[model samples]
Target: MRTFEYRLRPTKAQEQALMRTLLASRKMYNACLEDLITHYKETGKYLHLYEQDKHHGKEAHPDLPAVLVDTTLKRLHRSFTNFFRGLKEGRKIGFPRFKGATAWNTIQFRDAANCLDNGRFKAPLQCGGRMRVIVHRPLEGTFKFARIVLRPSGWYLQCVCETPPHPLLKKENAVGLDMGIRYLVADSNGHIIDNPKHARKTAKRLAHAQRNLARCKKGSHRRKKAKKKVARLHEHIANQRKDTLHKASRSYVDGYQTIAVEDLQVSNMVRNHCLAFVIADASWGMFRQYLEAKAESAGRQVIAVRPHYTSQTCSQCGESVEKSLSVRTHVCPFCGYIADRDENAARNILQRGLQVLARTGPSSSRREGPEQSGESPSVLKREAAGL
Candidate 1:
């Protein structure tokens, strides 16, 4: 399956209709949540959608529009299903909540009939008067569904389509990558992609915009304008970061068949206040996601090795040396080898990743840890660790 996104344009009247639909949805969402809470309080269990529907079906109210009520009830049902699923998966239960005034501004529809082509797919919403689609890239298969999304700057529609998988070449050579704050990534082949600090460069502008926004009175026209300016700045930063990740990951996928990387827990890394901005700017997790998707499409392999000793252990000597964040150079006492810390770490990661691949085989190549096939060494290790 492939997805394509296009910008959307709607007339003033159409935009008003869309807003009304979203308002109805939001009102319904809040009503359902209140109903659930009331039911749970009285009966010790939440009311199901069928029960709620039956109760509301008998009610006659001047304030409630039929369309709004129906939309709200359906949304309530989805919320309940999602809540139950999350509980089953040992995730925190999510309860539906009311949308604030600003929240309703970002409402969108998914899988609308008009957006789909022939019962097969929905058309892309275009800007201007005519329904136009600029083919940014050629697609291979039948389109299935299109989703409308409201962004801070404008609206966008994404179409999901199905296409036959094409054959992609698999090279024999492999490379390992080490991600760091100083350098974005260091490869086993002694190549380093320097950290651009794109976010940091734009931080002052973002800060200024935010400060200006904060000074504006709430609900005032000035506040709204300031808020939009801030949003635009954030959107710009996000786009730049996304572009950088795409370019960097695409280069790696195209150059090597086997890609190895350290399985760093990004959530934990972000806990450090000093490193949070840098970590967010790096977008290591997103980079890994892109690598996986591209690698899968290209029939390439991605291996993730435990990050535990990659930085401390010498790639050539297998000896551990103490190092600090301030230490940019890796000086191995055992072998007297000197190199950039990230470069040394990348080489170590490559060696360890290759060792894992040799032991577990290609099917267990994911860097996210191990396959659940009950045979991968990393999986077994994770099981032993109670992961």
Candidate 2:
């Protein structure tokens, strides 16, 4: 299934209505959670939606609208189903909990029939006529779903549709990548791509906007305007980062049939206070996600290798060399080889990826190997395969 996301431009009144809808949804979710807990405590059994609906539908809570009450109950049912599924799979608790003020701001609604195809997307409210939506991408598949999300900038709709599985491409060449903060990516062929540092470049503008936002009074008109200005700055930074990632990922995918990258623990990396900003700004997680989706569409294979000792082990000599983060150059005493630290790491990543592909056999007719300096047949195959 292909998913499409659209930027929504709601009028003032429509925006208020949307906010109210979100608030109502949040309230309903919390109330349902409370009811479930109460029922479980009293009867030693969980109450199903039909049973909860009978009780809630009969009692009138003056604060909540009838529509909101119904929606919330259904949401609770879905949440319960998900919670049980997660539990069965040894996942952490997935119950819907009460959202506080800070959390409430992030609350959103995911429901069916809210998609563009249903024509029910434009809802009438006090602030405006029908809500207008701009479709960013076309949807594909049978079942359609929509998510009303709250972002730092504003609200958006993500429409998702399920479709047939994509066909695999018939290509053989593969490349492995080692991503790092200093160098954006290193490949098996000793190629190193420099980090753009998009966030660092815009830090000054972001700081200025943030200072303005901090000085404004809470809930005041000036404060809201200042907050939006800061948010816009953030959006710009994010866009710049995403643009760089798209270009890099596209180039890699277009050049190789199979792409291998290390499965990094970004959350663990962020735990280090000193490296948190750099890690977050690098956005390796988001880059990998983009690569996966793009590769899927292009019928290429994306492999993730275990990251253990990838940097410390010498690719040529197969010997361990301890080096601190401060080391910029890799000098392997065992092999008498010298290279830039990042370039060496990238070559190791490429070798690991090729090893994995070799085990799977050639899914595509193209062979995964090093580019020969003067091999005409190999060069022709690489060109025909778009590598």
Q: For candidate 2, write residues 86-187 as lDDT tens digits.
A: 799755565776765446543223455344643335342321335556765566776456555667777766677777756554666777787765566777
lDDT of candidate 1 at residue 106, scale 0 to 100: 34
For candidate 1, the lDDT comes to 0.67
Q: Which candidate gets the maximum lDDT versus the true structure?
A: 1
TM-score of each: 0.78, 0.75
> How large an RMSD does model 2 have?
9.2
- Report every candidate's CA lDDT: 0.67, 0.66
TM-score, prediction 2? 0.75
Highest-scoring model, TM-score: 1
